[model samples]
Target: MDTEQQRFMNMKRRVYKIVLPVLTVSLGLSLFMSAHKGLLLTINLILLVGMLFAWLFLSTKLPLRVIEWFLLTLAGIYLLTMVVQGVYTQMLGHGETSLGDFIVWMPMISLLMFLLFDRWPALIANLALFTVLVLPAVPAFPRLNPEQNESLILFYSGIVVYTSLAYFLHQLYRTRAEQNAMLRFAYVDALTGIANRHRIDTWLRKKVELGEETGKLFSLIFFDLDNFKDINDIYGHKTGDDVLRQLSKVVGEELDHGDLFGRWGGEEFVVLTDTGEEESFRLAERLRKALEDHDFGIAGRVTASFGLSVNRPGDTAESVVSRADERMYHAKQAGRNRVTGRTMVSGDG
Candidate 1:
């Protein structure tokens, strides 16, 4: 997993750790404070113990994913109990009291939904709770006194409004988080944690466009692992992937600030920097040497070939990349590990 995803999971685990104990204590205090020693009290005691046990188990070797599922199930059961209590109270002609209690707890339930799950599951759970709460009020409307019915109307209205707003806010948060995740996946190479081909293309296009407008200088280095297929064939694909990831890191560390580096395809990579042709070629040679010196463990020593190109006036992304790629193949043809490139001039083919 990526760092961001790991951090998110850790935060969730911490929240669950706090929530379980707090909920158990709250229920325990409520059980003591209540006057009735009937079925409701028994249920509350049972739920309190369950929550306490869940909290204790959280710190054990039990998997956090299992605990998360348990909490969600527990929350559902708690909601069902509230609904049942509301129905029982209404049947006993305590509609006002029941509705008030539901109103007070409705926000808590909504908050729990937001905390426990992502947008869609939370929305579905809240919708089901809202439906249950409102259904009872409908048929029992005429039987209620005018004042009681009016209060019910107001309370139900508040419930709907509160849940609607909650849902909206949660949905907004979910949408943004999803967009961020999509962008990360789009731009990042999963194996190496570097920019992928699409990101490299996008960065180059922007740099090329900016250079065309303002006379800013930029260059690209297209390179590939030397004899990469042989390494994969000898050591298996797993170690070959490791060599790529390690080499990417080592070379990436050597690049200047604001430069972009990424995988271009299998065994091929690219780097972009705002440097002249000479500096770009020097940077490419530095990268080639760095990989040559590094030990790739199971893959043994590795080397790379590089080609450099300087951006010229009116140069498109395709033209600049094609030139560098052509030089790269030339480097491969001349020798296995080397740097070969030339700068282009305005109006030069």
Candidate 2:
């Protein structure tokens, strides 16, 4: 996974870890506080137990998406039970049929719906809940006293307010999600699932700026597959794509943390690192050896020509990448599987 997606998953796990325990405790307290017996008490007990199970499930190794759906399902069942209780109490005439009292949990339900779901789903759920809450009042509206009419007006007004706020929040969330997806699409290569050229260029410019400010140098390693077209011609484009994907995985395994590897273009890849000239050359050599040793299945053995270039004083992003590209070309001309920037060191130096 990419950094942003990994961070998002971690954040979700933390939020759920805290929320599940709080909800379990709250349900336990509610059961204690209520004077109800029989079915209502039994239902609350069931809900409390469900919350405990949910908490345990969250602690398990299940995927986050599964956990999210499970929690939302639990919430739906809980809300449905509450709706039944409210309607049954009104039918039995056990208490005054105050819409306000009956819907005391509506705001919380609305907030949870928006929090747990995306825009369209949350909106639909909220609207359905609102309809269920208001439907009972519809038949009795004409018989209500003036004070009751005012209360009904206030309830409707609250619906409008709640919906407006929920829509605003949903729009904000949707906008942010779309922006993140767009950024991922722009930066990530579709086929190999690595950084694309745009991302590489952006990282190069940022490194250039950082190097100029702190006098900390960095290097760029550019490489491309040798005899790649022959593989496409002999096998098919399908095998060629498999070769590129496998090559990316191979090179990725050799990279250090914080190293940026990207698809520079077709059959070409780049690596940006915080290493100097000698270290970058060593990394390039290691990568070249890795590609040489790995079997490409149907395409057989595949190799690449590598070039290394360290950041220079007053260097532009283009200048750094161009020098690396030039050296990569030199490596291709010299042989097909050699590093061309620096002297070859012995024994994986």
Candidate 3:
């Protein structure tokens, strides 16, 4: 998983960890407060015990999906019970334990619903609770005094407003996070965790434009593994991937902060540096020696060939890269691991 999803899951897990103790404490307090009332005592005791079982189930080794479903069911049933109790209190008044008054806390429950699950489950739970609460004020339902009816309507309004805001905020957060993840994924290589071809293309294009407009020099080096397919054929594809990742890491570390480096394609990497042809050639030679010297563990004794090109007065992105690619192939033809580049003469190919 990426960083964003990991962060989101960590936060959700923290909330889940807090649920059991918080519910236990809240239900215990309610039970203590309503000890003298038989119906309230019974309801609070049942909820407290249910919450206890939920906590125990969560503490077990069961699968996460099962535990999530179990917890969601517990939360849903508890909220429904609260709503039902409110409806009962509207019909037959409870001395001091008015279920209608507890409607204010429904927002907290709804918030938990959205955090624990997705919007659909939360929405269904909210609608069900809303319907139950509104029934007390409905004309077909048993009538209460005008003041009591007004209180229920106001309570229903609060629940609707609070839950709606909570849902909106949750969705907003999710959308923003998803967009960020997508943007990150678009530019980043999945295997190497560096810039991919598209990002390199964009970066080189911008640099090319800037150099052309201002006469500022920039350079590119296109390099590839020498006999890379041999590693895959001998050791297997997994070890080949490991070698690529390791090579990327070493090369990336050797680059300056102002330089842009990325995987151009399979076993081929490119580097764009803010320098002239000589410096670019030196950089490529340094990278070639680094790879030749470094041990790639299972792959062992790897080498690379490099081709270098510097930005010219009339250069485009494609032209600069093609020149570098051609030089790299020339280096490969001469020998496997060397840097080959030259200053561009007028109309030189």
Candidate 4:
């Protein structure tokens, strides 16, 4: 439900990106062309085509090859040509556009290029080339004023456009960065900063098909802090939490990025390792001893017992987890602060 809502909002955003601009331009042009000859109507038609082409090029699932580039290039060329034509219609004699206007419009064109190519330098270079090639022919465009102070107006106009665009881009980048950080916090454990249980579960579910396809087995290791309640009683919950925090940090730092670690519950941590018996047992033992030898200053000392189990053929996630849970209980029965592993080959009994 949340994902569906996100998609709907995203689709609405895209609709606004295209629809709002075209509609505003169309409304203004419609009134102007209603009084003038068919020139405004022609310009409006071209704008519609440009917008429709943009929607198709950006929204399609197909590869962004030369064909996509060709379409975008056409849209840019068309918009530029129409702008020039409007200027030519207004200019009757030796008219010229200000260099200021040239500067201002360059950034706008650059931004448009960014929207098209999704690369900065490439689009900036293209805009520079385009502005240089087109500026000299300003008199040929309709509705251009080649009169006094025109250069100054153009320069200021360009500055305003560029400043506005830069500000917009900066704001967008900052917003996205903040959003990404927030998402990371939500999915990560607060104390350990490792993948939380929710994330680990999601990861396993996503990879189930891949595991089946490869005929590969996966392992889960469950570890518990024995006498954790006693420690909490003697040391206080704060100290107990600190101990767990330190343990999480050490275990998290030692494991490879491919491994997933999560706080299973109070005083319990689990890991989903990609390796088999020997490697998994070695990893579990390594984590077990690291805590046994180390002393947490406030919490004094603690130990962790671990149980490992491999996935059986055609086993569900729950069944595999149950096997690991059973092994973990056995580790508790034998002694605290040790590692145990078992693979189920037969029935539930």
Query: Stretches of candidate 4 above 4 Å error?
Result: 1-148, 343-349
What tens-digit string does per-residue lDDT give for candidate 2 at 121-230? 87887788667656766766676556655666676677667866887887988799889989889999999999999999899999999989998899999999999999
Using lDDT as the measure, which candidate wins?
2
Q: Rank the candidates by TM-score, best first.
A: 2, 3, 1, 4
Candidate 4 versus the native: TM-score?
0.54
Clashing residue pairs in candidate 3 (N, C-alpha, C atoms within 3 angstroms): none
Q: What is the lDDT of candidate 1?
A: 0.76
lDDT of 2 at 326: 89
Runs of candidate 1 with Cα error greater than 4 angstroms are 1-7, 11-105, 118-184, 341-349
Clashes (N, CA, C under 3 Å) per candidate? 0, 0, 0, 14
TM-score, each model?
A: 0.65, 0.77, 0.68, 0.54
Q: Mind giving the per-residue lDDT tens digits that candidate 1 earns over 29-89?
A: 7667766355566656666776777778777878766776676566556656655554456
Reference-based lDDT, residue 340, model 2: 76
CA lDDT scores, all candidates in order: 0.76, 0.78, 0.77, 0.64
- 1-349 per-residue lDDT for model 4 (tens digits): 4764567446644754565466446545664555533654565565556555555654664444443355446546644654454345333332534321223224544454444444455445455645644574544434444462464355435544664575468558658957987888777887666677777777666555556778676778888988899978998888888888888888877788788888877777888888887788888888887787777886666787788887666767777778778888878887667787874211111
Tell me the lDDT of model 4 at 14. 73
